[model samples]
Target: MNKIKLVLALVIFISFTALKTKDDDFVKRSFDAATPLYTSLLNLTGDNFKNYPHSFLPNGTVKYYQIDEWTGGFWPGSLWYIYEFTREEKWKIAALKWTNSLESNQFNDKHHDIGFMMYCSYGNALRFDNNPKYQQILVQSAKTLTKRYSPIVGSIQSWNQRKSKGDINTWEYPVIMDNMMNLELLFYASKVTKDDTYKNIAIKHAEQTMKNHLRTDYGSYHVINYDPKTGKVLHKQTLQGFSDESNWARGQAWGIYGFTTTYRETKDKRFLKTAVKMADFFLDHPNLPADGIPYWDFNVGQAGYKPDWNFDPNRFKTTPRDASAAAIASSAMLELSTFLNGKQKEKYYNAAVKMLKSLSTDQYLNTDKANPYFLLKHSTGNLPSGREIDVPLIYADYYFLEGLLRYQKLKK
Candidate 1:
């Protein structure tokens, strides 16, 4: 390396480390304080709840799933983050206990969320401590996930034809941008097992999504219905967003996160370029509120309805904010910022900081424990289905904590 380049690298490191001190302390202390409440929830619910502990009802009871649902892994994953942030033994115990619940998912080839279900939980454990047991579990999970991949489509199928909502023939081998987030597990499995198949699947899936899932504006759709036999795209629509053309905040975040991870795993410049483009569209979108968090769907306007960031969701039901999307994007951006430098790096880092500030405020955090169920509030789940609307979600808290930790990492 050139002498001048070495000097400039030191300068950037010092600047990021200086910022890390304050932000790192805040995230560490906040999560440390919330640990007891999370533990209490785990104890109270125990194995009594059929599904994973995902969210809470208005009455404060745990919202759970009966089986290995897509979200079953977040609770354990959050516990792992808690342990990583605090280095406490209690959290490790909690993480192990919760992660063990999903052990059966290694055989669950029914859905395309094993990465979310397994990698997020067990994957984190192996990242910190290379447990041989965890390695086998993750590799098995990765293999099961690849079963959904179709050579005809050149991508892993996200939903099964048996599970499609409409006429079974209407949607054939559909893929969603969200599947991009799961590629990390395949990449991980490849490295640990020394098998190229996992890596190839991840790369191929990314290529397909990059080709068919993105709009001209670089925003992503919720689903891309593909003709399984011929690898032809049949339909592009937004099931969660307000309209087909409307970009769902969470879907865009998923694309940003997915491609960013692709860049990290493959070190491919195209992946980094695509991730930056996704960030540009998300952060610079016209409908983005001044507060930094986004509405559930960016296009949920009254034809020409202007967005009001401060509007009370209780009063205006037309548009609710998705804190979950903001949380996911914030974490991804902090990591993305590290991969770039100059003004481009600063742009992503600043945007992540702004969103973190908004989320850490009293407006978002539940300080008084009025909701022992969750940490943040007003996270929209699925507005179209009238489910989990304008409420706290488990994935929201998981990503928020992860984002804070990422912010802490950047400063260090």
Candidate 2:
């Protein structure tokens, strides 16, 4: 019995030492990889308002600007997040310049992604700066967001000019799963302005997402149709991924993070429950690779379809999985882990650490200085023309930094 006890003690010590060694090695590698990225990011920020276009380019040349794309939020948001982490004055300068360029969009009479486009940039800037002028910008942006609330739908319309597309009017006020995330701005506006309308709007939107976007098993679809006239859910589908019923990896990530954020703001049992469901779906999905990274589409393994035979030459036929999803999930898991206790927290923290460690070593972390960008080999804007196919993407880098910061904060 003494011999057996001694053997068990030895095994436990070995396991503990191995775990500690792995964690220490990961911290060293992550810090080393981020150093050059941190320096280059500083230089990029120092170039000031004149050099950067509306958004940052991977190669540091911003000759072209994509004004209407969803990616517009990432640059300034990234700058703001980076500044918060690094406390570098140069990052603030770059972010302020980007924020200053969005005066018209904040007050635009239209209502499509004002939360995503304006709040993430200007609102975050206000959070970082605490300047009255930035506060005013955020307030106006919030009012604009409040105006988007539709009485018919009890939720904000996700896009505009949907009916003007003639026969394509079948898409009725589509409230995507992605929109669940945008509700954060509305919830914040409620806190800032002491207004119940903003809070109500955010909760109503989340309830709608729960009713429409989520499946019985908690897997969520990307897009859902709402009756613009009656506010009823018409259908739910995966617009960007394999099919209407198939899971999109990133969409699941959005649901995981979005629902968790909703829980954070509301402390509502429903939101927390939904978050757990989504978390379980994400971690238990067999489609994910052993390394914790996921394919661009979760249904790719099951989808017996081919890309259009006349596919564009620029787009690769093969799917290069997205590193951004892993980054985003890692960050979200850290946040979600904090909200849980005991075994749940341990499981989530362990999963998050493993995913991040995998990302740190995978093709995602491009330490090559000639490239300049830290996180590479991402698949953003991969659909349609296949704009950014298996290349270094700015958002991937942004999320990687954000994830690292979140992980570091959790450790401390």
Deviation from native of the Cα of residue 176 in model 2, angstroms:
1.1
The parts of candidate 2 lying over 4 Å away from their true place are: 1-64, 109-111, 163-169, 303-318
As a whole number from 0 to 100, the lDDT of residue 116 in candidate 2 is 68
Residues 209-309, candidate 1, lDDT per residue (tens digit)?
Answer: 99988888898888888888899998877777776777899999999999999999999998998999999999999889998899998877537533222
Q: Give TM-scores for every candidate, taking all chains together and pairing residue i with residue i.
A: 0.89, 0.82
Poorest 10 consecutive residues of model 2 by lDDT? 47-56
Pairs that collide in candidate 1 are: 20-411, 51-65
> In model 1, where is the ten-residue run with the lowest total lDDT?
304-313
- Residue 388 local lDDT, model 2: 52
Alpha carbon lDDT of residue 228, candidate 2?
A: 79
Name every residue pair that clashes in candidate 2. none
